[model samples]
Target: MAINSGSDPMRFSASIKVVLKDGVLDPQGETIGRALKDLGFESIVSASSGRIFRLDIDAETEAQARKIAGEAASKLLANPVIERYEVEMAK
Candidate 1:
């Protein structure tokens, strides 16, 4: 394939993982664990809530795509005080 121009948009795929920070209470996770135990899931012990987002971005470069996704995560996808996020980008 021919190389794309600097201005040409390239397709990039990204996966973002957002989770609550340590020492934070996750009532929903605890509830899920309780429900699982009630359902005879003996191995169920602890649970934690987290979110993953898959995004397809059109940007000039992989770095740009990563920056965009990171900015989104920092601004909206996760809370700086209570949550942490990881962004992985691929072409």
Candidate 2:
């Protein structure tokens, strides 16, 4: 849970992006990249895949919302062993 300094939080938006860790194998991304090349897309040399989750949150403040969203990202949105996550908040 996020530590709140006050009550009656405002609504905010949160986004969680989950991507494969560095040095990890991403079969889906690799296959997509190959397909792009086979389709005469030479400019697409490095194509990677990731997951994005957009959520609406209510918290006491932006900081609290960020903290809560980050915790959710780590625990539910991403796999700690093979994937990394980043959480962002929107107005």
Candidate 3:
């Protein structure tokens, strides 16, 4: 939980990362990997594409905030079939 100085609700920020599941094709990541190799980055064998969503939420506790963010991600941010998502509190 967070302690507020006044009557305002406790607010927290969350970051959600959405990525394609393994065995799923990632064309954008492949393109970037090729481009990096062209630039003499041989050690970079592969790349994965993903989306980061930063959200500010007003809640009573950190757990509640995380739950809200996770719910949002599951409902709209990531596709359950081919994509997976992770939610964490933003520093």
- Best by the lDDT measure: 3
Q: Which digits, one per residue and each the tens of the lDDT, describe model 2 over residues 13-66?
A: 999899999999988999999999999999998788999998788887799889
Q: State the lDDT of candidate 3 residue by residue for 21-89, as single tens digits.
A: 999999999999999999999999798889999999998789999999999999999998999999989
| TM accuracy, model 1 | 0.86
> Candidate 3, which segments miss by more than 4 Å at Cα?
1-7
Q: Who wins the TM-score comparison?
A: 2
TM-score for all models, in order of appearance: 0.86, 0.88, 0.87
Clashes of each: 0, 0, 0
C-alpha RMSD (angstroms) for model 2? 3.6
lDDT of 1 by residue, 1-91 (tens): 5565555688999999999999999998999999999999989789888999988999888999999999999998999999999999865
lDDT of each: 0.90, 0.89, 0.92
Q: How many residue pairs clash in model 2? A: 0
